[model samples]
Target: MVFFGKKSPITGKQNARKTTGLKAASTRSIINKYHQLNKRKLQLQGLKKRMKKAEEQAKEAEIDAEITQIDSEMEKLGGLEVYQKASLKGQDQTRGGDSSHVLLKWLKNEGNELALEEGQEKKLLEVGCLSVSNAVSKSTEFDTIDRIDLRSNDPLIKQQDFLKRPLPKSDQEKYHVISLSLVLNFVPVTADRGKMLQLTTKFLHPQGLLFFVLPKACVENSRYLDGELFDSIMASLGYEKLEETTTDKLIYQLWRCRQEKAKYQKFTKNEVRSGSTRNNFCITL
Candidate 1:
């Protein structure tokens, strides 16, 4: 679910891009447009959900039309798969090819205080999974890795939305680790994002690990969210940050469930901070 820059939509050339300022500018442009389109798509999806709930025909047709338009645009821009490939390419060109390295590191770190009983097999859920060959998938740490994405054609990655997945009924059905890499920001509705977070508790084993990843800007530069605020939200949900790392483009955090559904603060879209060019990323409960 990693989202970042991509190949030039028109030229599709990278030799020149590899050695000049033009590459950075091109990457920024593609990434910006990618985020813009993704935001609009999620908004339309939220509207569609409301339309389904209300069972009203008044705005349904128009909403469907707009969604079609956006889908067409996304198809031309290569969908999320292309963005993921581009992200992998950058990783190959510079750092490691996936965020799983960090997640695995967090799990192995001694600072993670969640002590597991010996011989306890680990189960992992990789939401918004794009590939079956990812590091976590191949790792021996987990007894099993259930990979899923909202849109996927690969047989290995189930094409199912996490929100729609059946809720776990018992500890046996819950996962030991859940990877939410770059998936939260894709959730357009602020409340829905919070709902998604809360829902994780039902699917996770007590004291399980959750690896959360987001674009650096979501916390660093968003008008509605900041580092402290995001921390409070997770803490209120009973998730304690075990480790956190911020790169130039991404925010990675490994959290342990301390308590589930604890008393928490409620937040809204009120202006918490002001900036002329800030992103409107926020989560609510």
Candidate 2:
């Protein structure tokens, strides 16, 4: 069954914002506000220069609108009064938080080395990691990963060969955990999706958890149809449906029960006979 959780609220009260005497606070807030205004003004100037150099008139207009919005927001907060005062008093101002980083941080905390026992040669693979390399690099758990990046352009692992490479065919019984996020949907382009699933079973030790973030059609409109197809592929390839929550009709987070390779051999053979989509991104990109 799919379930959805409400969005978490921001917690600003716990932040280290400055609290000073009424007179001092007023002065600091005004100073801080002005400093921010000045910084934004400089950024706008820089953006205008870039826009002129690129002759991107439409982009320049969009940027102008954004700067105007920022100005309006600043005015609503207190014009330059709040920032100017804060700067003069060296007081810190509070801003609202981003939930993605917060959620990642909490997940890292839960899965850190201190939270899990140390082991030799911890295997970790992240496909379609994109710009989150820093986050993965800093993870207490991924720290232990013998980092195997599948989609890397670096001349290390043969591109897309990881899917075809022989995995621990009968060893779907020993790893502690497996994680896939915003990645599975990309498989139809670079590798055989069914082969990837079989490889997953081969790599995962028995009892290992399969954690994945399902594609959101709203966010990944191009990949939405493929994402649904992949979910069906997962079930056929031996993943037992476990907990899955719908963030919305278009987005879902899921956990699947693990399965072994020998059990799905017949299904895999049938998949091989029917040929599949491959190397679409390589051609498009």
How do the predictions measure up, each by TM-score? 0.79, 0.40
Number of backbone collisions per candidate, in order?
0, 30
lDDT tens per residue, model 1, 1-285 = 212122233223322123222343455554555567778767666656756445554667666766666565556556666555444454443543488888988877897744456776678889878677777777888888888888774898888888889998767788888899888987777998988888887787888888999989888889999998888888888998889998888999998886745667787776778979998899888
Highest lDDT model number: 1
| Candidate 2, run of 10 with poorest lDDT | 1-10
lDDT of each: 0.73, 0.42
Q: Report the Cα lDDT for candidate 2.
A: 0.42
Indicate the residue-level lDDT of 29 in model 2. Answer: 45
Instruction: For model 1, name the residue pairs that clash.
Output: none
Q: Any runs in candidate 1 off by more than 4 Å, and if so which? A: 1-31, 44-66, 90-96, 113-119
Per-residue C-alpha lDDT of model 2 across residues 93-208, encoded as one tens digit per residue: 23211112332443444322221344534444543332233344466554444333444434432334446545553432234445555344444332354455556666655544
